[model samples]
Target: VYKGLDIVTAKVTKEEQAQAVHHMIDINDPLKEYTVVDFRNKALSIMDSMIKSKKTPIIVGGTNYYIESLIWQTLVDNPKRAGGDDEDSGLDESLIKVRRIDGSSNEELHKKLMQVDPDMALRVHPNNRRKVIRSLEIFEQHGVTHSEILRQQRLAAGCSLGGPLRYDNSIIFWLTCEKEVLDKRIDARVDSMMDKGLVQELLDFHELYNKDRLKKNEEADYTKGIFQSIGFKEFHNYLILSKEERDDEKGEKLLQQSIEELKRATRKYARRQHKWVRNRLVRRADRQVPPLYSLDSTDVGQWESEVYGKAVDIVSAYLDGRAPSQPALNSVITDTRIADNSTETSQYCEVCQRIFIGAQWNEHLQGAKHMKAVRRRRRQEEANEYREAVEIEGKDERAASVEAEA
Candidate 1:
């Protein structure tokens, strides 16, 4: 969401953007952090204006959290008014500051969250510093735990954690691709970016913004703005090289390594996007979701007929209040073993030294790594027990020998 990071982001060129209007493109300063909440608010305002003009505002993006904020009543605007109790219902004049606590590590922030809202802490991993901090901010700003706010919302709406849908007349279209095809497409895209002077773009950006910070021995903050973009951090080593060094053989190898890393990261990110669609939109049995139509985009050759054509027909049918010929995709069957209240809470495995949230715990228990850890621990315990037994036997014999000698 910043200027000058266009190549890595694969931002549409001015020519491409001119073909159609786009919102929220390069609207924020690169130095400043632009959050999901910020995106949601601005996008919502644009959507409202479009609705007034009788325009169908089609929300298109890969960022699920930002899309979730727009679709569901997830964010707690004001806790006082949210619960509708006799408690302070007045607007909080103070801003809801969702930032890290100064001088506190991620674990420390998570501990503070555990103290205030154990339920939320259970849901969020400590390593996810941003989310842990956000949960803490909720409690600090509203004088109510983040979990409590979600509970109140659930009670009020008689629905799931994020409450009901913001718009009743809404539909979701999930465009899916085959895994092998997607991997190839991602690699090709990365190659295209490199051909489009991605290295030079990073070099210019680093020279402009990051050179001074590096010279001062300050760590690169990848948590903010355009720095968080996949290509930037992946190319850090190559970007830091001097012009003469960058021309050397070692620098060429490093540059290739960076490109490979970028490709891998992009592929990994694509997998996460697919997982989000499956977990959040498709198989979430606990919450009410809009009808989702899956469009197979695996074969780019048939994009018009399989994807675009199907999407247009589905949208038209929905707008006309008629059922489309193509039926909505069914939710994937949830695992009965993991589909329990217990799974909603966090489960920590001492053997693995890892915390698993919700269904993750069940999955982890069944995983090879966890089982291996358990077996290793069991063997260690057995060895210790056998050693203790031998020592006891030796001690008894020594005592009897001493008695005889006396």
Candidate 2:
């Protein structure tokens, strides 16, 4: 929305495009569902072409998971595509009647997954139905449990989890900023987006894509596509307000509220990015994981010394085939990895809608809440079966009476 001023803009100036090539930017319509799987496939294709041409592909973005999937083979396919792309995970795309956990309650879905793959169910949170369903779908399509597949991948990678690295020679640079400075920048950025007509941009997007869905009171899923951007859902209520209401004091209050909410969401998303870098990127059970050099951007005044100059020296050394030196000021996280013993078979409690790992599963099974939920589920099953039986009996009686009359 901020045009050239924005960091993730695809509309690069003619001069910049002349200097360097860019890939995987503005490749999809905002309304359509462009999943991460799609993104990884497309990006890999671009990276391969660039590599074949002897060009170094510089992947720049804040989407840590996307970058992770690109650098590491995290996006594993089902058995059919074990050594292939996920374009054909052996799933039928034509079937509309495919059983999905999307509309089902968390408890019901968890129970279903438990019936098929109890161990997998334990690892997945009940609230995260999308992951649960995807795991179940993989099991159904490939006839192998998701956990088993992950176990195989981990064994191959020499780690407790995660797959092999796509590019071993890759060096990653992580830009770090102090929490106070970062938060303030994010707040200021949100305000700048507002000045750049963020609200109007959201309104335009909603009208173009979401109007039909909203008119029918259908679910506006912010989980998929470009609508997952920070500002879209934050201004949902403000967008839905009528013209009359929007012109009043209530609209002004809601707009201010939405601006604050957008700032808060941006901050939370920034924290999540940092967490992914720390936990997934840096901390790995396998020592072969890629080394990430940290670059401190806490002080903008020292950008030339801390960020740009240091980056230049590291890249130059890397190109010269010398071991890249770590910056003294811009330090790496040296916290040793702690072993998690929870990998032992986990169980899901239907009552608490929670998964208990290791010994906790046994304790949870004997808990009062779980026992009560079990009893309730049994009662519900019995009632449903009885109702079905009654309907069958009524049909039989009607058939007998018709036969007698004939």
Considering every candidate listed, which one attains the maximal TM-score?
A: 1
What does each candidate score in C-alpha RMSD?
5.1, 11.3
- The alpha-carbon deviation from the true structure for residue 225 of candidate 1, after best TM-score superposition, in angstroms, is 3.8
lDDT computed for candidate 2: 0.72
lDDT of 1 by residue, 327-401 (tens): 876444444311324228777889999888877888999999989999999999999999999999999999999
TM-score list, all predictions = 0.84, 0.76
Off by over 4 Å in 1: 78-100, 211-219, 240-250, 330-343, 386-406
What is the TM-score of candidate 2?
0.76
Mind sharing the TM-score for model 1?
0.84
Tens digits of per-residue lDDT, candidate 2, 165-221, equal: 889888788899999999999998777777766777677766766676777786877
